[model samples]
Target: MASLWSKISAVLPLNEERFPLQFGDRVESSVVEMLKRSRRQLYSDSPSASRTLNAQVILDISWERLNTGTWRHVDKEWRRVYSYGCLFKVAALCRENPSEDEILQAVRTCDMSFLMGAAIMENILQDVVQILQSEIRKSAKDEDDSEHAEVKRIKIASPHVPVIKDQLAVPRIKCPSLESFNTNYLLPLKPVILEGIIDHWPALNKHSWSIEYLRTVAGCRTVPVEVGSRYTDEDWSQTLLTVNEFIDRYILCKDGGKCPGYLAQHQLFDQIPELKEDIRLPDYCCLGEGDEDDITVNAWFGPGGTVSPLHQDPQQNFLAQVVGSKYIRLYSPEDSDKLYPHQSPLLHNTSQVEVENPDAERFPEFAEAPYLECLLRPGDVLFIPVRHWHYVRSLELSFSVSFWWS
Candidate 1:
């Protein structure tokens, strides 16, 4: 409920003159300008005729980092926010030239700079913690002051029923339906290990995809670009051309290196043509539904160089691995006692804890948090309910797919 600006300022040492926390059009404009400048290639290379049409789809997503006011409207707010690297992927292309699948794949795959953004945010949190320490030290001598006395008060509720580590270790079983899962595990906000749900999906089966098939389905395929002379860098792009072109560029073509196994070309819906129409699960009577219908196909393409920091999804989700391997680290929603999610509507309000080396002094509750380690190989899908915190690491240039529905 406290403001991010105030909370961050309390912990980090900062001068109002240097880093003023203000929200207005100027800040929004700055973000717009930042995105525009970053898309230099897209403007220059993309065909001039379709530039306006293409730009229309570039929705002005009002994220807290870009617009503080938009964040304020959300119930939850987080301190220490910063964004680094390219926010969205863009590439150069000639006019009148139809956008190629390679271009689109490159754009999707290249939006990986979010990892760099995470590190920048951590620095901001460090500054906040330092400020809090200084304030505490100053109040140590003022015992009689009510403000000082209140600051000294610490709330440490005891756990009446200690949860055994072994008990928590047992993997959960998948319910017969989403309604059962919600009634059994969600209403109370408890975490459970799900089994068999992912094992039954066709995509998670033991079938190896062809080079051509993987490119069409994976969404983020890269195109090769020429280097000095011997080799060229990859020129990423996207277009809805025939599947044959996809295989030609990403599957069949070889650079100075070989393609990764998980990066194969595969079509998930080809096997289940009915899926293409229902790529995203539509609303069903039994399962509770969210406001939006756009909850079907949510996929992530983290190639050799991307990592999703510890964060949670807004809705219940089923993460199915189509190709490649990803090391998944998950924290349950109730563990929010430790992860510290923002009470905001801006879906991705995450805690500022550095998972690699959590500071016990700053986030003491993390000590009580339980974590689960699972490696998602091809065909293994992990079920993550809303608000469950998790982090992902691409083990070997992975390609993973997920299906989400309301």
Candidate 2:
């Protein structure tokens, strides 16, 4: 019986020990009675006779109270009871063949403490919703199977490359006047690799900006780091660690098995102001319609194999390679339809097709897109126009700075 209970516990999201059943032997009867009493109390005083009580309503009420700061001063026991009711509704909704007995059993086994159990209940609800949505989409797709099949057949035979006569390379320029840069690249909305611009920056010449030097200066400062090779991976997660710890784990102690960790697109200068003295804003950025304070600067530092998936940014970017080489690819906004952007809200701006090893069967349209590719070395800055799809992969342990402006 104990082993059976352990198997059930592993399968279910509930914690049996935290929520002991109130009625030991009469589990089904007690659950039914408790639910009836609770429902009556909830709807009894309501004036609207047609008011519909559902799991979503319970979830909304609980979420609003918890997230909107309304329950901050509420009694702890009352909040627990409300959270328990929410969990009960979620369990009832998630069960495959829900019955009064089964739902009550699940609820009774769930942890009743709101603070401890709410996250588990929420995750369970999300999983159930995703399953239901997937079924709905599958049913809809089956209805249009013939049309989809025809489309797939056409895509398989379609010519892969765009009609452009020749591949274009991003122009590389040494230090140019602000006027020439504005006219040649900035106004034309074309990308250019700029050299000699960052030659005067103190970080280029200073040993204080080196990896060991950074460990000594900002070692204790905690920052958010990405703990996966790519953000698109299921195992990707963010965690806070000190600079020295990140260096020790991802940068220096790199066993072949170490997953990529990136200190990416973070405003590290604001957090550790002492590090900002290493670099300066380019004169070309001042030509735009913004004050010096309006320019947003961010830092990107990571070990080799770190990837930034194909995504577009809202503001124009000048990505300066400070430490190591990076391979970059760009697609124009005109070819966005060919890129197969993700429909999900979290990755809407990102392309679904992997640039490195694109599956031809899945993303046939990608082959038709004209693109520009480059390899950026130290002191090279690449101009990326706003909304242009760009992907980056670090070839070596790298530190790069990005300046964003209108």
Residue 324 in model 2: lDDT: 72
Clashing residue pair totals per candidate (backbone < 3 A):
35, 0
lDDT of 1 by residue, 60-165 (tens): 3323344545534532211112232222222221123323432333233222222212323334422432332333333334224653332222112111222335
Candidate 1 accuracy as TM-score? 0.42
TM-score winner: 2
Question: Lowest-scoring 10 consecutive residues by lDDT in candidate 2?
Answer: 157-166
Write down the RMSD of all candidates, one decimal each: 23.3, 19.3
lDDT (10s digit) by residue, model 2, range 63-100: 44545444555444334434545545534333344433
The collision pairs in model 2 are none
In candidate 1 the C-alpha lDDT for residue 388 amounts to 76
Off by over 4 Å in 1: 1-170, 174-182, 192-212, 216-286, 290-294, 333-337, 340-348, 360-364, 404-406
Q: Give lDDT: candidate 2, residue 80.
A: 40
Model 1 weakest lDDT span, ten residues long: 224-233
